[model samples]
Target: MDRRTALKHSALIALLGIIDVKKLFAASGNNSEIRGFHKFNLGKLELRVITDGHILMKPVQPNFAPGISSTVVEKTLDANFASKSEVDLSINILVVQSASRTILIDTGCGANFGKDSGWLTENLVHAGIKPSEVTDVVISHAHPDHIGGLTDKDGQVTFPNARVYLSRIEHDFWMSNSPDFSKSKITDEGLKKMVVAVARKNITALKPQLHLFEDRAEILDCIRIKLAPGHTPGHCVVQVFSGQESLYHVADLVHSQVLVFEHPEWGFEGDTDFELAVKSRRKILNELALSRALVFSYHLPWPGLGHVKKQGEGFEWIQQPTVLPD
Candidate 1:
């Protein structure tokens, strides 16, 4: 079946991180949408997982796990009991409410991608938050899926009331007259150009509200941006703290909870610096496993709240159970 046909035929709730979908399970009404948004609490802060939906990449060999063949990827998938053909990349956006601030870690794909992937805005409302109520937007990087929702087609900022924060390195990399992709494995020049166009547009629109922070800078009282690089020169992860509790928002550190966790050296073709990404992944994964801190993944399964653990050769993602507040 074709990609759309396959997706339409499949029930992807199980397809966890830019993940794995086994079989087709048709849906009715708001059920699928209801599945798109999840809520819970982290210490004194309230958090929400609002997905912009997902991206389906078929015959994942070339587009993902860049250095390996589809045959190799299939073997790994087969061993893990996941689908051996494609992936439904989850686009999980995090919303944080702390005392005086309502923050969004990464804006969803918006309409830049398509209908199936721009669910962030409405899902935000259903989750009882409004775009205008978002006081801050902490961008992990400038990928289309992460920043596309920042502005409308008319190039106007969507979250009018929010001040946007991005790592200074990330800001400069994309804003530079010539953003380099020499190290990227992405062979499609069109897609690369689109990346440039989309990034510059939304970033330029965010200029007035944009605040550039240095690596390891704590933009908020409880949230700090840490440099992770590799996927993009400026790509970074976020750390959220509450009292003694903390959660790491590891954005695109690895796209798949399976492929990446199983093999930190593998990466999607779009990685700006695949080798660098691998090094960063190994370094950060080590730290996370050692820290045993709670984590939130931008592309992991719903809610994307989990913990990291050392397994055989690599680490594993241990998802936390959702708990409702009294």
Candidate 2:
């Protein structure tokens, strides 16, 4: 080989080795725990997060402003210490394991969305659950983050032995042949492909194992599905109850922790019905604060277990730290 080319290759290898070393050391320290998982027991109910990771999306101006002033929107974002008009949304999947059933609230981004997600399966296994052992897969909505993990990398069912549950309205909206599909706010073709793939595998078309429930249907003994739409046509949140203790899984009810909680009126472009979404957010936030029920949010930071506290006209979210099992 030519001397110059050989030396260049050696230098490249050395540089790569250095990068790897840095990453290894960082990972061994705090980096590996980036997407954390935590578990809590409310009497007999055990609720946990199988973290799927997070993403930074370019903030669309429509959802941020709508009727509000740009100054107000930008000021709110700035007040929250965010920049670049970028919002970081953390994704966490809820795992509810009890004496009666093993339920997963949302599937999370499947294997193909990129590196930021598709970790739910691994975390599930780590949490001492086999994919087949998941008895019920309850979807909060049909959004990608909530339903992506329905199929695995090979386009196979991730929870092969589980009964899939979803809101009938959510199922109908995505499967509708209406031209309104062209007007969807998010214009990503990948998203459309995902919707179509989901249509092909629509729970209705699957085994009788798939059941469609209307709003406010009780899925099992202590779990009730409540419709909290406006984010989508059929978005529903799952609430788990055991005696007096309860955990509310508010899926995508709020995306950006700051944008949703601090500026409750600000637009969230991800929602199909932006105006309606804001209304739903306000209502849900009010209920959450008043009810004092512990909430498990799908897009909140890892181990997204926390409560909403009333702050003036709006509210603030404070995530509870890990509660070590006794």
Candidate 3:
């Protein structure tokens, strides 16, 4: 080959080497997978957020935005560069270690949900925690995803050594013989009934070690339960305070960062009381935004820790950068 041609080829190869290989692979539909667990410290408290994987859900479902127009939903999703037809919903399980006690905020979907889910146990192992080592299992609500991992397929408690703490109102609501399904806004009546049944069974199985607490009760030294009902009759949020630092676990208060934060008025099908859900979401988000408090959401994304900021009439979720331990 001529010297000029060889120089030109060398320049082209150097240019290709300088280009971002990951970006090129992403353009070709390849991307790196998200890790299953993340850890960060809150003063003296050690917090670990574990992923149970994610599922792709259709955004056009009947109750996704009950009375909202498709045009508005599509525009909001498009603006965020999210999938127009589907949304990726993640399941986050929090593990808190304080004063020699290991606590779990909510269990993830077990073998029952689907193939994509049920990674909580595996991730827990990866985090160097065993089910038997968990001292307490604090449930925010009795939803299928949160309570499904309470027991195994053989109907035995998964956390054999842990005492389960759940809200009194939540336990009663699920155990009630006649739950007021008429008030539910879910479009699929069948799904609503199935969820109720599963919640009831899961709680019943854990009754032996169950310790129900009322609203605003301190379950542990630094952990307190705040009643935030709406998604369910007794849905609650768990707050962990260590010294002056605090981390709020906002469970299912906002499903999608784009849809819920950008448009809090939109109704979610999973919420039994749609209007109340909106009210609770706005009230809590306003407080968090005003206080600039750190938050750990169950469905926002992997690690789900961030701060809420007020934007126009709505709010915005600013995810915390992942920082691994040294």
Q: Each model's TM-score, in the order given?
A: 0.87, 0.82, 0.87
- Per-residue lDDT tens digits for candidate 1, residues 1-326, read 85444444343434433333211222344433333356677789988777778887776777778768767888888888877777767888888898899999999887788767877777777667888899999999999999999987677788999999988888888889998888889888899999998989999998999999998898778898889989998899899988888889999997777888987877778889888988999999989999888889988766688888888888888988863221
**Better candidate number, 2 or 3, judged by TM-score:** 3
Candidate 2, 1-326: lDDT as tens digits: 76444434443443333322112111223333222356668778887776676665765365444556777778777887766377656777778888878998888878756887777787777667889899998888887777878887667788888898888898878777651443235566676677656644645444467788998898678788888877788888788888888888888888767767887777565677766777888998899999988988877765678899988877899887753322
Q: Which ten residues in a row have the lowest lDDT in candidate 1?
A: 18-27
Candidate 3, 1-326: lDDT as tens digits: 86445434443443233432112111222222222357778899998887776666775545467677888888988899876787667788899998789999989877667877777776787668998999999999988888889987677788999999999998988898877656557767688788987898888888889999999999679889999988988899899989998999999898889988988888587887778889999999999999999999998766688999999999999998764322
Model 1: colliding residue pairs: 9-24, 10-24, 15-20, 18-89, 18-90
TM-score of candidate 1 on Cα atoms, chains taken together: 0.87
TM-score of 3: 0.87
Each model's backbone clash number:
5, 1, 0
Name the best candidate (by lDDT).
Answer: 1
lDDT of 3 at 200: 85
| Candidate 2 ranges with C-alpha deviation above 4 Å | 1-36, 59-70, 179-184, 187-196, 199-208, 323-326
